[model samples]
Target: MATIQFRLRSKANKNVSIKVRLSIDRNNVFELNTGFSINPKDWSETNNLPKQTTPENKLLSSDLKKLDSYIIENLNTDLGKSILIDSNWLESKINDCFSRVVKTDTSLLINHIQHIIDNANTRKVKNKIGLSASTIKNYTLFRNIISEYQKKIKKQIQFIEITKPFVDKFTNWLINTKNYSTNYAGKQLEILKTVCIDAEKNEIQVAPYSKIIQHFRESEKDRYIQTLSFEELELILNVDLSNIEQLNQFKKENPELTKNLSITPESLNNVRNWILLGCEIGQRGGDLLEITRENIRYNGKNYYIDLIQQKTNKSVTIGIIAPHVIDIVENNLPKKIPHQKLNEYAKVICKLAGIVEVVKGTKLNTETNRKELGNYPKYELIASHCFRRSFASNYYKKIPTPILINITGHSKESLFLTYINKREDKDANADLFMQFYEKLNKDKEPQLKIIKSGTND
Candidate 1:
């Protein structure tokens, strides 16, 4: 029979470290650190246990008893005697008892991430049965990044090693070495924290230091968002793409540029209409490109674009408020174009529409393959996402936020506000506040009156 006992290292009035003694007969004996401490006043010399007068003493005694039973049960098993018995082995058993470390392969950080990726489709979010395709893609990318980081450190990340300093090092590496934006690094760290939180929910033990791990604050430069204004949208909507003969003539003259682009007049025309539709509907590019004539529905008095959003699986009915948009939806809904084509052609179309205002934003450098911040023509930054943001920004105060949330599929107002760069629109918001202030005080009389400095008026 194997026996386990806990005792203080040295008797003292102050806190003293506790040690574990394990005996397998008289021939084999082992001592291990218990990672616990207590004062001599709380000890019971006769029983070799803490006195049960205080709650702390009771818990310590209870944990020591559990450790004793746990060790004896394991040592009595055939599996335990097959391996070598040493101080290190006894220390491992003590760690297991206290949950100071995870001993299972399933609890490894990389292995757990693989498990999460494999089961992503079956996992539920809100009311949906699976994560969005984009979300899964991002998770796969983050997994690759974590693998590279592990290689850099020459260590496999353990769930118990995800502490504040570990996350800080990872984030700094992402920003400094990987050339990732602060917000991008923060988002990746958030995903890592999410995995840890999910692991904890499944009864996995992580390091106590992980509780202090937090996301990096978004940098001001990264927080700057660029969206198409109403003027830009109108310019795109009314662009002169009807002159196919002139477009063909220009393409004929610029064969070197047009050869690879395959920019037909019809393609440009289709992209133009798609951009307008996206601005009006405020849906994601994936869902926006799928809109066809069939999505239009008549509600007796008004026409609506009814469809289920692909990412959220939530149905939204966009009421056709603008007469021009309603005209296009009812009669001239453009043929579906490739989402990539929309992204590429959108820049060309906007550039042709004379949207060349210099703006501060991030754009991909082809050589580096990373988005770098610089001043660029607004048209260069225009993409499918710009349309949704444009719709949100253009109609922010004109329409209620909740109604916009329904259309844009955003879960909350704060996220939507942040998405549209509300913090950067202080001047416009100030004008709106001034308008409301005047309206509230329209009929009120002035309270202040001029008086001499020496006189009590």
Candidate 2:
């Protein structure tokens, strides 16, 4: 059981600071500041009430009594009984009381979201590191966009006031007014939904807008899953950047391509080797570029690349079997390549290798600042992601699905297949059904019968 009573600090002037003293089991005790000061002459020590008959004193007395009763009521509730009665619990209850009594609208939509962002930025996860810097930046961007939306509408909204219509309007505003792409707009809404979920966990009021948020899912049509074929991969690998004289002669022959080929022979070779390693291992740019001598392990017969995936934080060990992969590991184990520069150099390398076959894909038109889907030369669509997709696509059927899934860190077969853009053709379809058909008829004997034709009769 707990007891609550009002007490006053020493007088500084005509008034003294007042606070509530809480005691549990007659042993544990703590004081909570009420942020109130009252004249000592007006306070009655006998009844623990203000002696003044004025409206202000009457209201103050009634508030104090109500606050005491609220604490008592809460102590009897399920949550109160489950939690240990302590200073922290008392402080939280006091805050809840103040929020309900003083600031009834503290849990407004934008206000609570801002609170969540602030909390998230300070939270520590995994090895005591704070939220990812990129994530914090995104949260700042989300807040700014929401602020703009509020200003444009000339209206402030509370959490309870949010509805499905509000979500639709905000989404439309992001797309039509802000000129954001569908996928980008959907990401913004997804961040908002995440904040709402966090807010709900903190007991902040939020409208049920998850159903509306589900409608703004990122569309698959907006994504471009491009990859390099075995031939294209070979083309990139075979590009001889080693002979500087030949490269110089080739540059002179194609003066227009000299600007892209201005990189030093050594730098070009480094980028080439990095791309080959990425293709062979199927690692993301972040994970692939960061590999070093320390990440390589040898068990006498075979070498392996062991590292934790940057995005999923799952540890994976990929076997190094390809001759080119083994060569890169033996020679350039600790190579350093910037991800952005790698992507840029990869495009140039692919172009120099004559991998200019036109293909249907998405390319960003810098002049128009929008992604346009059309037929583009294969080199134009080359990026670090292509290496991962290429690795997945090239060896998908050759390797066992479970083992491949382990190497790729993919949890689902459908997602893995989609990542590689695999499809069922006539041969593959027939092969799949044939296995089941053969098994079903394995125990049954052949049942062929001869039929006489009408002409023969």
C-alpha root-mean-square deviation, each candidate: 13.1, 10.9
Residue range 175-246, candidate 2, lDDT tens digits: 887777776788898887877776677777777874246536434554567787888878888987778787
Question: Any runs in candidate 1 off by more than 4 Å, and if so which?
Answer: 1-102, 217-222, 248-259, 424-457
Encode model 1's per-residue lDDT on 309-413: one tens digit a residue.
Answer: 987788999998787788777767888777877787888788778898998888889898898888998888889999999899999987767789999999887
Candidate 2 structure lDDT: 0.76
Query: How accurate locally is residue 334 in candidate 2, as Cα lDDT from 0 to 100?
Result: 32
lDDT of 2 at 211: 28
- TM-scores, all models, native as reference: 0.71, 0.64
- The numbered model that scores best in lDDT is 1
The TM-score, computed over Cα atoms with residue i paired to residue i, of candidate 2 is 0.64
Q: lDDT of all predictions, in order shown?
A: 0.82, 0.76
Q: Count clashes in each candidate, considering only residues at least 3 apart in sequence or on different chains.
A: 0, 0
